[model samples]
Target: MSPPKETNNKINTAKSSDGTIVKAGPIVKREKVILHIDGDAFFVGVEIAKNPKLRGLPVVTGEERGIVSALSYEAKALGITRGMPIFRVKREFPKVKILPGDYHSYVEYSTKMFDIVRRYVDDVEEYSIDECFGELTGLDKPLGMSYRQIAERIKKEVNEELDLSVSIGLAPTKVLAKVASNWVKPNGLTVIESALAVDFLQKVPIKKIWGIGPRTAELLNRKDIMTAKDFYDKDIAWIKLILSKPYETIWQELHGISVMEIDSAPKTVYSSVQKTRSFHPSTNDKTFLWSQLSKHIEDSCRKARHFNLVPRKFSIFLKTKDFEFVTALILLPSPSNSPEILLPLAHAHFENIHKKGVLYRTTGVTLLDLMADFVPQDDLFGSNAQASKFETIHKQIDLLEEKFGKIVIYLGSTKNAIDHKAQDGGTDSEDLDKNLLFL
Candidate 1:
């Protein structure tokens, strides 16, 4: 990428009430253009997309987990916040609608949304399920449209195709693009030209800046730096003296210099794979808890197998009704991603951690110290042969799952978790039927 271009023109100048000239800063000419696209109330939006009648209603997801995961703008207006207990919402806002989360549908919509942007820009970063950053520099001529026009086209395509609203920001840097995208909400399109960036920054609180958190905002506020413009006006040397490298990068971005590059590569490696599920109504049933943990093992192993990775060690934990965690870490005899090997070990260790009469609300498993799965050399004990056989069986099972649906064929231990309706986002028979329609 070329270095960000700057000009000496002093733009955003204004006359104060006393007729004095107020200069915000020099105009930093646009050298790079980046677009940030974010969905409007993503989870709730997906639910509304699947069923249009749910729109214009106070809706929230996470009914299965007994807490709010995402809420519609209508729900937010009614003082319903994310992570708030569902029982309270029902008691306080009885008119509000609570629905179970359907992550399968969310992932499908996310893929389609980002794919729409990828049609326009090759360098698109899938920042999250509902957000992405695309590099739009130098595409105006080939596309026969301005950067803003290209952004508009992408946004229009996503909205029309997915029946979803996305807010887009066009700016010279990622941070500014993020700010511009959030400037207006739901279905908004805002452009922060390099010359006008300072004008926008003047109104944005320091805490609202992309990477700055509440603690950092408090620290900056101690020094009376309350707005993005305030921080941007400070001396570069002073910023370096007080803040860390990340903040310095933000400052450079605030100066219309693109310090962060768009990362578009797909993730293939992981340090660990963790799967957790919280269910409603804590249970002391050992079979249910084991089934939940077994399901987690299968899910985590499936992910590891997708990346051709094996874990050298793994851990399991159970969350009690009081929110206390009882965890145990186990080292494997060999690195493997097959749940056949993990389930038995987890069952044996379950006894050590399971306290009788303890009501648990969550079960989790983490596969750790992962490395590439390589063919093992033959051993005298024939354990390698057994593992290879299980691997082949799992490969066939994966094919079956791809053809049918996830968990169509799972271990007997996981049957209770799948058959039971009280966990994994509280997906019951009715929710399953609705989800099948989306597929």
Candidate 2:
């Protein structure tokens, strides 16, 4: 059978050690276990860990209009929430002190944590600069106690080596492990024993299952399915009928396999991004369409900061209901990460796209011709001023975003035209405004 496509977002179910099909609970990375190590309060955690003085204070990271992008568990309990506008966040819990996140620090600690995981597990996938998913293959040597032993070993090393805590979830499949990892926060390792998966999966809300976020879960709930078991009992067509392409992957992974191809080679890290979500389907108002494009480009730039390379070219992809496809790319004089520059180009691309006079079902903005922060010597201009300018401002804005949270800061004047801004007024500088910000 072609690898069974994931049909749901719930991954808590798996075949047990005794050959019984059930839900996962207190999962430990067995021979087949996938240990997903997810950072809790990542940016906030790192800052607190770096400086002892930051501990236990309701620390919000970001700048003006910067909401809580990542809240420490301590902060979360105080009723502070992610995406709550910083202004509102303060109003809700006025006593909390906010600190901007440190990107370089996050990357540094993330590297150290993964280093420990590599010593024990042969397979490691650095899913992001902050999180990792690792496979502990060939654990048969430790006999009956290997999974629990390694899980504990990983936890101990992280505590001793980095002084940082991570939540670990273990299961037979990547999806379950990812969900399990999140079950415990800050410092926790939860294992979903194969036989107990059914009970565990049923108790957790569908949204808690990872792939199904609030929006998808609401849709699932409308269909009267609220738990992993509901999705499990759901037929293939039921899944297809109710879920989108993304949720399909969740369902298959719940069964201990995934449609995703896993290999040692890490997937290409996107240096640029373009995302467009269809509005109420009217697609008629050009102004609304333009806003979406602007939002798309600005969102990509936020993530561009994480990739470490600036982009010099912007590419546009437009799709029409007629299934017509059009793509165009523009190369700038220098690499850039500012929406102000890219949005104008995106508008120009859309203007070209509009010439066909067909309603668009999709639109995308891509940054291409990516290069190092400093461009190499050019024949036309021996000492390029533009490249130097792009680098300085890029770093500055990145610093501001890292500190302020999301799109709270913008290039020159684009700060006024912001979407995805949290109640604190911080906007998503990254793609999750469109993709995971894809993970």
Candidate 3:
């Protein structure tokens, strides 16, 4: 890949609110305000928000033998860590609440959180289900408050409205904002102003810098850059020689420069998409196993369509109760995300891997070698032309499902998986009404 375009080294001056002339490198730096908001122990917080009695008690989320997905601060204080199995937690902290994850409620709270942030800043990036970044650079005059004050108010409003604790960080760059936010936890607020940027860097390890993973951290350690301050103190010429363009941008951001902007749009491209699920009891029923694979394919296709992408290859795998895997891979007749074209191929390949009397516990499907949905492909004719018809019908079905709810209209083959999910405590109340239609 080509290297990132180099920026000039010219310095520029700007007037601060105090009318003091401030100088910055490369780009003319104004008071570039970026705020990051992170929900504290998100899934556990949601459970606590739903049931106030759970407050101050050790709470964890995950069920059906899955590892711990989330834990409350109280649970953390009690020496409970994430990814610890539920059965062990039961054996250890028997009083902790280990409820099944309510994904629907989590999504609801996430939407509410984003809605609250949007009220204050138009440029809001939903970084994750529990994190968001909002731009407040030019809003100080109109909002009648400083950037720090705006961040403080947002934290207060989220707490009062959602009853969930959130830690917030304000900085001139997105990377610094993320660092500041993580520095404080359980409803703390931190600000990394340009004047105080070096102080913050000096206190953090190089590994703690946003975007610096273990491999990069080790590389920097070899150069004796143990702290964020050490990395920041590197010469620009050496940084360009040692690190890639992305690292160079982070280096600049550490110095209180805004090289990265908040991206608010949903991701439209992916290298691959996968869906998987395990049922309560293992089954050897061939039809039931195929149904599960069908459902996974349908779900993967749905996500591909949401991103306007198409896959050229698809694969399926089934895990046996004895901890053995049966897998198959096939190149598609055409690069497509329409379930109609892909499901038949999935079933055809499954035939090669299905072993009689081998009870399977889980099934999964992955769409790979993805490309833009609109990319040109070989012209369809006769039997191949039917794919176009299927595409149009599935597009309509997608819109209807988006409006009404998923499974309101679905493939007949997936009905068995839906029924199995309902019987095994997988389907929630919202899905029950429409799933009954298939019966």
Candidate 4:
């Protein structure tokens, strides 16, 4: 853009801590040190990080059910994406090395990179395993350098440690930084002046901004609003009519708004949550449903833990091949560590939703009525005389798992999926929380 911003007049010189001269790009006027790093072809990058041999070769990972979880740039250049069928990926990129998703590897890289980032910024938000946002507030210590200085260091650090490249985008607002980061991708930094954000976005297509997907772009296109600038200073009612959903946020982002209003406060309400499984279809045995639920419970709790929130009640819901749906939420005395205690609770709900002889193709478990963990609630006493002892054992199990590892514990009833994975030790999915991987 603008002849890549001329810098031929300035002589650049530096050592890369390796006694090597660093060739520099043009001098850019960077305003805010809001750094965004997005790992290029992330899951594939992880595969290469773990086994360098996987580099250069096209690699695709997912399940035998034929879903593409992640693709190397080589595969992507051939037109593959997250949910494309694996069979087509194979047919298209025949040279590609197809493997089941190594989610664990992705998790490790995600954790390690952030551990490094936390050293520099106080507010580092992990948006996903492959992307993150960092904010630089004080001009106090490394206080003197331009915003570009911080972004360059971050880019170099991540590349060196992760053996992968990440594009950095810098600006005043999160939205602008996010857009700038995407400007020059696959290992580059692009910074837009805070003042010029509106003008800059006008030159870029509407689809370039986040949240505006294909469907949104098509709608905007029909209205002759093809770029971010097209939406700027436009009638609010027109945008509301056009967007239909998330209109306000879309308008603000287009105007260079930094704070993510919805995420800024981070709602704690556990309105409802659902997890689904795409099975092999061969193993539709009614019993296999428990494995899916165990995974769902584990994942839901992890999300609950992340928000520092917990649920006082749980609900189990299911869908069948016939298109029927059913759900139930069992109230618990106190918030539990996970829904492992809710196996029976889920079972009770299922009994109500279960339709006999209905060949169910898909199923889900939902948890709702969430409350902050601090809120007190009563226990669900059992019918047996040893009910008190049962409750104590359950609490003890949670403590042990919390102190040691989740594998250091087990629940007899829901042990099917949980135990199998733990006993096998580490698979690619092991990198994610057991529940998340399973879900």
Q: Best by TM-score, which number? A: 1
Give per-residue lDDT, candidate 4, residue 213: 87
**C-alpha local distance difference test of each model:** 0.86, 0.67, 0.82, 0.65
The number of the candidate with the highest lDDT is 1
RMSD of each: 6.2, 11.5, 7.2, 7.4
What residue runs in model 4 are displaced by over 4 Å at the alpha carbon? 1-33, 63-66, 137-141, 214-219, 240-245, 261-275, 282-284, 298-309, 320-341, 374-391, 402-412, 415-439
lDDT of 2: 0.67
Candidate 2 C-alpha error for residue 392, in Å: 20
TM-score of each: 0.82, 0.61, 0.78, 0.74
Candidate 2: minimum summed lDDT over ten consecutive residues — where? Answer: 430-439
Which window of 10 residues has the lowest lDDT sum in candidate 4?
430-439
Two-way TM-score contest, 3 vs 4, winner:
3
TM-score quality measure for candidate 3:
0.78
Task: State in Å the error of residue 158, model 1.
Answer: 2.5
lDDT tens per residue, model 4, 1-439: 3343333445454433324343333334332346777888787788788889988887888855478887787877777788988878777777878887777778898888877766666678888788888876444246466556766777788788889778777666677778877766677677665455675787789887787888888888888888888877687787776566676676766565554621322235556655665443423455666666766776676567546566667776666765566666678765653554566677666666666666666567666676665523334454322434444554565565677654343344444655445554544434333334121
Residue ranges of candidate 2 with Cα displaced over 4 Å: 1-31, 140-145, 258-263, 267-271, 274-365, 368-439
Model 2 over residues 271-323: C-alpha lDDT tens digits?
Answer: 55666554324354566556566666767776675676678788877667665
lDDT of 1 by residue, 337-400 (tens): 9988888888888989999988999999999999999987677477777887788878887787
Q: Please give me the total number of clashing residue pairs in predicted model 2.
A: 34
lDDT digits (tens) for residues 131-178 of candidate 3 = 999988778879998666677778888898999889888788999889
